[model samples]
Target: MTLAKGPLFLLVLTALALTSCQSDDKPPQPRFTSDASGSQVGKASQREGQYFIEFRSRYALTYGHTYAVFGRLNKAGGMINPQVAGLAPASADAAPYVLGHFIPVPATTGATDGDLEEAYRSASWRILLTEAEYNKTVAFIRQLQAKSKLWQATVDNCNNFVGEIAGSMGYKTPSIWLRPQEFITKLREMNT
Candidate 1:
């Protein structure tokens, strides 16, 4: 008995079609670091030796007023004093009623490393990220600077800025109503 050529061709074509439609069943291969240790070193640990964000706040002369500063630790280390950013009154008349839309400013202006010591009393929270994650976080911060109004004192102020940056680094946002000191405590609690 001879099999017909048409039937044989149809069977082969059907087999090929079914094979093409089938899903791949192989498990995904695992990714590993170049070290061969099977352990991954985080980005913060890799580049900076460490990485951190600090919040510094002090009570102003006005009873209800508090001035807060936020900064990232320099890759050189905290001993070098991180570059801090904050909001200050636009003018002397702007004081006391500091709750206006002020622009974001570098709190420490033209100050030497020696000066930063006396200028800020701060508490910091540290984090670790992969190199890719660090780059992504930086890009997010740059975008924020470009688009966000960065109005100080009024409603969206320094605390909001820091909180947003921290959140990008996988941190939870503290209560908007919390004072700087209280916010620091909350950050520590969440990070720890």
Candidate 2:
């Protein structure tokens, strides 16, 4: 095999092994990480003008996706134009998503079309932020968006993306390699 193909071949083999292995021995039952039941999507304080940033996970075909939602709550405890952002391989084709497992692919660290939808949501951890704190965090996320330019399943995937944001905010983050469901749950447990 050519030198270049040698690395690619090994990567494919490794990705296959990783994909075949289960995240844990846990049951296949649907693990719901949020109990908000759609009335709300995450836990937050009741006071108005309380900003919140939620680290969230949602189901996908394979490992799933992790993202962040940040916004100010109205008097009724509803989010006002909640913003969503995450890192994912930039493509609509399955080839890139699958290829991304073995090598870094172009990434988009901004909104995905379905990020705000509740349909696939599996987990969330919300932190209430004061106005000043909210501004700081939002600015940091924007910086992340600008600097984050690649996604690889093993190295800097979605879980790792969210973990970076959480860790920056002084929250304890679990292993970035965990499946999204487990990662968010562990994040909540470690903090609360």
Per residue, candidate 1 scores C-alpha lDDT tens digits across 109-186 of: 111222134323333334444456545765666666655543444345545656777677666768544554455546
User: Residue 78 of model 1: what lDDT?
Assistant: 41
Residue-level lDDT of model 2, residues 83-175, one tens digit each, is: 988999999788988888777899998777667777777777767766777888888899999999999887888888898888777777897
- How does residue 178 of candidate 2 score in lDDT? 79
Q: Least lDDT summed over 10 consecutive residues: which range in candidate 1? A: 28-37
Question: Which candidate comes out best when scored by TM-score?
Answer: 2
TM-score, structure 1 vs. true: 0.49
lDDT at position 60, candidate 2: 73
Off by over 4 Å in 2: 1-21, 24-44
